[model samples]
Target chain A: MKLLPWDYGVRNLLRAPGRTALGAGGVALVTALLVTAAAFVRGMNGSLAETGGLRNVILLGAGSEDSVERSEVKAGVAGIVAASVPGIEERLGVPYVSPEINVALVVNVDGQERQASFRGVTDAAYLVHPQVRIVEGRAPRAGELLVGRFAAARLDVPDERLAVGRSVDIDGRPWTIAGRFEAPGTVLDAEIWCDAQELRVATRRETLSGIVLTLADDAQTDDLDLFTKQRLDLELVALPERGYYARLHDFLAPVRAMVWTTALLVAGAALLGGIDTMHASFAARIRELATLRALGFANGAIALSLVQEALLTAALGALVGAACVLPLDGLAVRVSMGAFGLRVDGTALALGLGAACGVGLLGSLPAAWRCLRMELVAALRAD
Target chain B: MSALVECRGLTRVYHKGDQEIRPLDELDLDVDEGTFTALMGPSGSGKTTLLNLVAGIDRATSGTLRVEGVELGALSNTELARWRAHTIGYVFQLYHLVPVLTAYENVELPLLLRDDTRRERHRKVAAALELVGLADRHDHFPRQLSGGQEQRVALARAIVTDPRIIVADEPTGDLDAAAADAILDLLGALRRELGKTLLMVTHDPRAAAHADRVIHLEKGRIVAAAAATS
Candidate 1:
């Protein structure tokens, strides 16, 4: 069937500037909220997913498998695992074993106290986790701290407070920030790293939080499991690093669900408001619609024209929303696991635009149906 | 003359909370081709109903309505709309010019239904505007035009598709005397010059005087038929 002129729909939007702006502004707000929620979920999930090394294994205390922060491996387990596990990956004859401690400590930065995630590691961590790169200065020695790029966001402080040569007070003692490191898209990007020996002394802890070791290309996780089982007296459990992070991801499923549920509720409300707005807008044009029908345009054609108007408004809103969201990319957001940047990636953008179009299409239906359902004679008589 | 609009026992029933109201009750009428006829009646009479039935914009609850030899009641909604696009041009009492479109675009609306290129549509639109004596006001929107000019643009829209019959409902009801006379003269010109079969519903005797024949209705049935003197 033939359609109405495209300019007809476009011109109708300009007829009532205030109503059009209000409708578009509502849609823009919804689109922005949807994109931000999508970005939040993507960033959180991505941080956990990207943090794990495919061939690395974590040896945690048997009962503490759920959380490395609570896990306490015997301090000597890293050396024992290196000697017993035949397929351990080694570089320059030094096995890739990082005995690490993970803790959440209250640190003072620029006179403000904040809780920050701290990981104690040796040089072996760089060998096992290849994604980390020291972008500034050098690794932290004793009485010094290596700050992640997102450490400031995680600490809720200014970036300059975490910069090299600045001091962060730990356990009431000032530790110089020696350097900065970046592990993009990973949870490690939000942590402050120091010497494992120093952290042990600072906390007076006798056990390591966990031992992370990389396996050779030919090695399977079964080799590490075998070693852990044979040395059961050590009370160690072998788990793939990826599997650990996956468990953490599953543990946070409720948080993701809450985020999605909240976003959907708000979007649903916005959709309803949009429909109401469109209904009023179309109701005012019932006679004009009927006049078109009287001129031999079918109801379907008229309805399509209304949809075109709505889609145009929604497209404008989507552009504004997308522009508003662009600056949020790579901006850090802190969670209990540390911090991750809001990923305004292509996938998130697609979802935002798809939702806007969906709003436009679905929002116009009830109004169109209401306006078109009237008998042509009655509609023409309507005031 | 052959009958262009034939109505046999035409009826229209409306229901309001268990009450059945028949606007046109078993009415029979015939409108000949190339003739101008006006329907006159008081409020609640089915003059406008009959006009709508002939224009194929409303369906009869019962009975047959044939416009230009096509059985309107037998056709589906889509077919009826298509038939209306090809055969009928409707003029509303309010002129009903789409407010957002310019005079030229308002007149171009009916032709958009056909498979015409932009240049072809522009040609038809220009000719229609010129015929209505508003070619210079083509760029002005309905709000920018006077009531008479808007009615003329509406007339241009009605005839843009060159339909065989034009159905007008109180075409001069909302205009002043001078404006109403201009519209009536255009309505007469449509019948005399273009040979269009014109069926108009009007409340004014002066407007009815322009028709070749006048049919008066009361309580949904034609009560009198007379030839116009003017």
Candidate 2:
């Protein structure tokens, strides 16, 4: 039988420009939501990985692997491990080991109070955590604090409020901002760093929260596992830094699931709405389809033409959605742990196109079939 | 003249809520090749039903129906469609041109089913539009054309495939007298000049006058047959 030309579908889409726009808009919104959700998951995972490195190891009190803030070990254990462990990373004859104290302290900036992680460390902390770079000003000493660039944002204060030379009140003590540092793509970007000894005296805490150290080249997790087993009486646990973040990622699984579920629900609703609109549109043209059938075009051909029309509309919607996602690449999102940047990559665009085409075909095919299945005379009688 | 369409006791029955409706009940009829015949009847008298069966768009519930020596009742839906595309050109009462397509594109539709090249399709579509005196209006959409112009475009679409038989159901039903007369004259010319068989259903007596012969139907049965001049 005679087949309808490909241009027929395009012409039909333009005939009802308003409906086409509405359908396409719905599809575009769904695509944007899906892409955003995917980007968020990617950013969160990447930031967690960047915060932890393969050769680094964290030493915490036994049975406190879930949270570094709650974990504690004797402050003197840092020196003991450095002298005992054989494969400890050393720079310029100095072992790269940092004894740290983590305290959740409230800071007052411009009459506003915000909670922030206060990390107290020594000069050796910079050697173990290489992601940290002092972008402006020097490192902090006693009575001085080094603020992360993102730390200001996390505190809901202006960037200039945390500038070098400004003073911030932390737990009734005024500390001068010595400098600003950036830990590119790491959770450390959301913390305040200060002198460990001063922090211990101010917080009335004698115990260190954790010790961070770098393993020597060719040293594996087995080396730390042997160290921890050899000194079980110390009540210390050694965990590969990668394993630490992987556990944190597991803790945040529900958040990722919730985001994905919400995205899917929105996308599903958009598909159903598109199908309803397409059904009504094709129903109104029943007589015209029957006329095509009478002119020797088969039912399959008519259905295919309708599907092509719907896909074209969806493709337009996908283009709009991809445009919306363009600005979100490298956009930062803050959570309790740290700030992470979203990666809106080509994979997200590819997934959006697939979903848009699926919505287009699934939404239009059934409606076309229903119209074509009616008796020819009855279809022709439709007004 | 040899018979091109033969309907022997053709019956079509449908049921609606415990009641059976028969539009064409055991009806028998014949039309010669290249003849211009009109079926005149009141509403629900089976005129349109007979035309649909002859055009291969509908099937007979029982009895044998043959068009151009092909037993239509025996062919599957796909084969019947292929046969209709090459054999019959159907004209509708409402000038059912697709609103989205230009007159030239609409007329070129039937040729797309075949393996014709772009140049061949263009040549055929251009000639059909010219024959219907609409070559200049080929680029206009159905909505852009007047009722008379739309009907002429539909006529051009029908003849574009060079079908052997042309079946028109009240081709002039929606037109004014001027347009109706023009459409009737065009149908007559297609039969006389191109040797295409013509089978049309109409309620208007003036429209029947254009046919070489007329058959009157009542209650799904043929009641009278006469030369239109009589």
Tens-place lDDT digits, model 2, residues A1-383 = 34578888898888788998999999899888888888888778777777886788999989898888898888899999899887889988899889998878889887789888889999989999998999988999889999987788678777799999999897778999999998866778778999999999988887998899999988776767788899988788988778898899888999999999999898888888988999988998999999888877899989989999999999999899979997998766778776667778787778777888888988898778888899988999899
Per-residue lDDT of candidate 1, residues A1-383 (tens digit): 88999999999999999998988888888889889999999998999998999998888999999999999988988888888889889988999999999999999876788998999999999998898999998999999999999999998888887889989898799999999999998999999999999999998999999999999999888878778888889999988899999999999899999998998898899899999999999999999998888888888999999999999999999889888997999999988778999999999888888898899889999889999999888898898
DockQ of each: 0.84, 0.73
Interface RMSD of 2: 1.4
Off by over 4 Å in 2: A1-3
Q: Which candidate is the best by lDDT?
A: 1
How many steric clashes between backbone atoms does each model show?
Answer: 0, 0
TM-score of the first chain in candidate 1 relative to the native first chain: 0.97
TM-score of chain A of each: 0.97, 0.90
* Candidate 1 chain A weakest lDDT stretch, 10 residues: A223-232
